[model samples]
Target chain A: MSFINYSSREINCKIVYYGPGLCGKTTNLQYVYRKTNPDQKGKLISLATETERTLFFDFLPLALGDIKGFKVRFHLYTVPGQVFYAASRKLILKGVDGVVFVADSQIERMEANMESLDDLKINLAEQGYDLDKLPYTVQFNKRDLPNVAPVENMNKLLNPRNIPCFEAVAVTGPGVFETLKNVAKQVLVELKKHY
Target chain B: MSGSDLVMYEEEFGKIDEELQRLYIQTNAKVVFLVDKNGQLIASAGETHDIDTTSLASLTAGNIAATGGIARLLGEKEFTILFHEGEKDNIHISLIGQRIILVVIFDSRSSLGLVRLRVKKVSEALTRIFNDIAAKSEREKSEGKIDESPFAEISDEDIDNLFR
Candidate 1:
């Protein structure tokens, strides 16, 4: 659910980065926070446990330049990837305009990736949003790891919809911006359709 | 809590800003702001220059969401009000119309009872204003009068320019 403030001439959209535990959802946000210009980004907040695992979520507000006259701001959030944090993930998904599934590309984590995707779909449905109708994309993260699954196989299993999947190494920042840009573009286009 | 997007026009925003300003002065708050459930800052008043309101709005919403989750497990409908006290400052958060959040930041100069009393009055005013706005937006949307989105003409080049 985007918020269009005609008085302020601004548009705000929420995007959630979701995946299984240690699949680099926080890494994706950290990379963006580090690379974004100071004026373009706000504080990167992480509500994590003592060992640094995300407990609630990680929030990074980015001000992408104006589209026409409206200042386009995107609030990027990452859910706590641990399975016990399902309630927290559902809370973070409220009013989301788009999603980036940061799937771990390692061959051994295939089950985790599949389960996370199923959870995403179910949670979205519970909130009256169909994953098929929402502006969404997938990122195959950890491509730098040697034991990664083939992109084709990952796409076949995870992305049956074939909606703009990217190969990414989120920690080092390859394909990070690409994934964000694609999803943001799709969200803006969807906003256009609504009006 | 509605599924549709929130569209704030100039008129409704003016009314909301006025209410916030009144609340700010009445409660002697350091800053008062309105945030939608999605954590978008709607309007703010008082001394906000030194604060990072964007981050505050996000965290506040997350806090409310977590509290609401806990309320459900205990078989409660929702915990609509939350207060947090620090060494020198305190925060009073309340839900308005269950769709917007009213956040007041104050210090020892104002007591919680005073803040709560003023907030109740302001919340009533805000709820009426928001209800009117929601109805007006729905009417405009259904009548096809709300079709002035600038993205209608946005090109691929325009979006790529943001990254540059």
Candidate 2:
């Protein structure tokens, strides 16, 4: 959901970074936080558990350039990727305007990637959103690893919908913002359609 | 809504800013901002003005959200007001006419009655502007232009370069 401030001429939207454990969702954010100009970003809030699993979520508020005359701001969030943290995932998805499914591309993790995508669909369905219909995209992360599934194979298996998919090594910052921008753009377009 | 109706670009900020300045002094509230439930800030006035108004705007909406949960537990259709008494300062949150949030941060001196009465009037004025903004946003979104932003054309290499 987005809020438009007639007083200041600004528009704000919420975007979520979602995926399974070790899929580089948090890494994607950390990379953005490091790269973003301090003036254009907010405090990167991470609520991780004692053992270091994301306890609740991570939040990063960013200012994209203005659209027309309205300032477009995005609040980026990432849910705990662990399967046991299902409840927290649902909470974070509330009012989500867009979703980035960061799929781990290492060959060994293909099962986790597929299962996580399935989980995302189920959770979204519970909240009245469908992965296929919603403004969503996929990033095949860990592309730098030799064990990584070929982008073609990953796309065929996970993103058959052809909803924009990207090749990325999130740890190295590849395809992070492109992924964000794609989903954000799609969300804005979807919002525009409704308007 | 045409650019002419934009109070920010057309209306003299001095007038509204001064109005907010006076309200801040009279109320002695630490933070005061008028925002729709959708989390858009209309006008902000208060002392201790160094706060991050942007995040404060969103955080105020979050507070309202948590309160929505509270209202559900109470078995009501919705909640109109919420008060939180902290150690040094107390927070008074009220829904102004069901459209905007009237938030007042004050210490002990300002009586509850005073805040309530002031909020009643502010809420009425805010509700109209907020409703207009909402309607306009609805119009824009329905037009489906958000997908056309240039940023959407970015590629994997562009995102990778961002990290540098």
Which CAPRI level is candidate 2?
incorrect
Top model number, lDDT? 1
The TM-score obtained by model 2 is 0.73
Please write out the lDDT profile of model 2 over residues B33-145, one tens digit for every residue.
Answer: 76545444557786646766655555676567556656766897678888888888887888766556777888877766777777776565555554665565456546865
In candidate 2, what are the lDDT values of residues A1-195, reduced to their tens digit?
A: 565444566767778898889788888989989988997798777778877677767778887665656667788888889999776676676667788999998888889888888988888887677777778889988888888777888888898878788888888887987888788777766655443
lDDT of 1 at A126: 87
Candidates' C-alpha lDDT:
0.93, 0.71
DockQ of the two-chain complex in candidate 1:
0.69
- Across B64-149, the per-residue lDDT of candidate 1 in tens digits comes to 99998999999998999999999999999999888999999999889899999999999999999999988988888789874665
Predicted candidate 1 versus true structure: per-residue lDDT over A43-94, tens digit per residue: 9999999999999999999999999899999999999999999999999999
Fnat value of model 2: 0.05
Highest TM-score among the candidates is held by which one? Answer: 1
Q: Give the winner by DockQ.
A: 1
What lDDT score is found at residue A55 in candidate 1? 98
Q: What share of the true interface contacts does each candidate keep?
A: 0.78, 0.05
